[model samples]
Target: MSTVEACEAAQTCWFSCRAAALGGQTWTDGPLHWIREGAEQNLMFPTRIPADAVQSAVEEARETGVQIIGAWLGTEVDASALAAAGFERGWAPSWMAAPVADVGVSDDPRVELQEESNDYSDEYADYAEMLKLTRVRPQHTWYAAAYVEPGKAASRKLAGPRFAGRAWSHLTGETAGVFDMNVWPRFQRRGIGSGLLRAVVAAAAQAGARDAVLNATTEGRLLYETCGFRQIGAGITWWLHLEA
Candidate 1:
């Protein structure tokens, strides 16, 4: 899938060019946004950045509620400068993909991967439980904050009596997508995760998405492989915070 398309599907994530959107004229929504007030030039040329230019964009983003959130690119130019410029390593999560309906899931009978049409708040409780149960996790606190905060990916909203985590599964046209799957310790290894993944594939098939996507972890890898998912690549992120 196109990185741009993936960004739209993922919501919180953005490609390198879209990262420039973070530097718009005004900032709103919340600190979780990737925008910076005067970072357009830097966005255009992330590499070979002038010392003052990089500093200016970083400072501008901080001055407003915008957080750098990091940048994404196809090349090492940005990563190299980001590292030398003091941008810390955000994450190096494994990017995996799977062909729809290729794997067998043993958890088919227990849980049902229904389309959660309700708001994220409705799914918040389940989503939170999933996060808590997620022992093998990404290497950062930012991801933890994501589900807790609204607008960020993994966020959930209240739906009627229960909370629902929304995603491409909720959107029109796109079906094959990943979600925050959670199973309590008491319910561990019972096939909930696999079932949910199956739900994703099923949902995608219904919507026309060719495959399911996710940033998988070590623990989830086996489960995913068992279900026919393959590792697409590794997602390496570089984060820079400009100190005034």
Candidate 2:
């Protein structure tokens, strides 16, 4: 498979995992994978173009009063197809990938810890609070936080938010997906983001992932490139509003 295909597959796995963790459901119909966490959190990923599944989903959403967000995996799918299906183009994120072996570890003064679990409420809270302090809104529900301390301090008082990110690996697979990597505004340029990224990548590597993939924001693109990740393609999400 092409690199974009591999990355998109890994991302689909990540979305599946997200649905499971958030008490949702996932299923596949033809080349489209559907993930639904709630009425407000329905998403579709099209792995192939000319997918009649998109039109069918739009019809279903119209009847159910639900919103459908379609994520176009790679360049193969034309934008007009989604437009025809009544989806409006939204933000585009860069698809990136790198071999796990090529991703180097960070040696910043702060201690890093990576946690993989179905629930990340505590970490998510810290991540959300950091974003709040920085006047940025938190975008994801799962997160790992990197704090600055003399050592692996056990108390929150002894450490502060340096960096935070989220990642998930497919079961019985070699691909992992990284998401929502962020450095607290006060900690930017301190190498903490690298430390946090390395920790997340290492966790996925330990979980049998040979390659790491992620959708990077324009602002975070340089940081990921510095960590040996290259842009393989780009993905755009289109929204279909059936909710009334």
Candidate 3:
């Protein structure tokens, strides 16, 4: 195994948990990301961020000629800073899923969660899949990103090379967030959810993550609970269409 920690850092998919696989265009400033560009809308997704450091990100983007349609901040950040920079949220008020390490994972059998094997069989291909659950509707390109990020699974050289998905462990720091975990509907109820969850928990422990976080779905919440994972908070991510 390449080690889950190595995989997550190589990918920038920390807290997102592959939540929104939008084919978002991205620019990087060290670890900070400007996801989705070249449209009436672009997003500011900051990780390892300090509240006041956000506007500096906006200022940096301006130097590169990228027009920021809007920005998305986890509740821990101050949106007022973005307003000071001349942008306003175009959608409903937003919130974030809080990180909770104090909680534990559930050990239930209604589901078996495991790491995604990049194996694509017609049988597995037809499984019912739930990547991420969100309250906001997204722009077309964002939707495109979701369907594509899954293919990155093919990049792995695991035994079940046909599978495609993402996993993370927060060793030393925060773990790699589990983005989209699902069974092809044809493969559902076979403990696949639980299997994947177990794999992630093990991966996190190995990676030395302090804890893991995910923006779970209603159907998936039970799976997470069974794995000893508890909910700490919820988030609302927004997108604004601009005249690109």
Candidate 4:
């Protein structure tokens, strides 16, 4: 698939998995596809929204009491309508992709990786704690975390997690989605990030995914690129706060 097509597929899979994990709702209206996780959260996908549809979506969000409405707008997508609807421009995140086979693996012995299939498990609690330390909300239900001690691999039952990430199954075509990757501030340069990434990407590939994709923060773009991900598309995030 072309990079743009791959990006779209990745996004669809990410949103679908997020909906499943969060008990969220999703719907498509005209050219707009809406994914809402709660009363306060809503996101529109594929950018390229027409002005009328943007206005309509905004009006609907207001009616439904959505506190935050987010959209990743393409370079060509008009920002005027969103701005008129009270949306403020935010950071641009890159949509990235890599072939499953091309993704690099980390064999760092100090980093021990663990996967959490149950959201309520203590392992997940550890993961959530790490996420909170990084100022990320623990919204997804499933995840994996990497841990380490001075001289040995950390045990889930004995030690706290230091970094967290997770991969979603391929929900749209053959593309798997990666989300919620974060490393603790002190562990920044350690191979913990790459180890966690490889573990999840390997899991997705084993589940029959041919390609892995994710949306990368500016700070994370280089790490992902070195691990075989390349930028396919870049988009600005627009946020509309109904309460404000």
TM-score (all chains, Cα) for each model: 0.53, 0.71, 0.43, 0.75
- Compared with the true structure, model 1 gives a TM-score of 0.53
Between the candidate structures 2 and 4, which one is better when assessed by TM-score?
A: 4
List model 3 lDDT by residue over 141-188, tens digit each: 011010112234444543332232333333324443454456556445
Give the least accurate 10-residue stretch of model 1, judged by summed lDDT: 139-148
The segments of candidate 4 whose C-alpha lies over 4 angstroms from its true place after superposition are 46-48, 106-142, 150-171
Which of candidates 1 and 2 is the stronger one according to lDDT?
2
Candidate 2: C-alpha RMSD after superposition: 7.6
State the lDDT of candidate 1 residue by residue for 151-200, as single tens digits.
Answer: 33423553222222222232223424464445445445755566656654
Q: Write the per-residue lDDT of candidate 4 for residues 156-219, one digit (tens) a residue.
A: 6546543333333232456667777778776678766777777667756665668878889989
Stronger candidate by TM-score (3 vs 4): 4
| Clashes by residue pair, model 2 | none
Model 4 vs truth, CA RMSD:
6.3
lDDT of 1 at 135: 30
lDDT of 2 by residue, 46-157 (tens): 6464647667766766665455555554555666767877778777878888887788655654634433332247756533333221121222222346665434754766
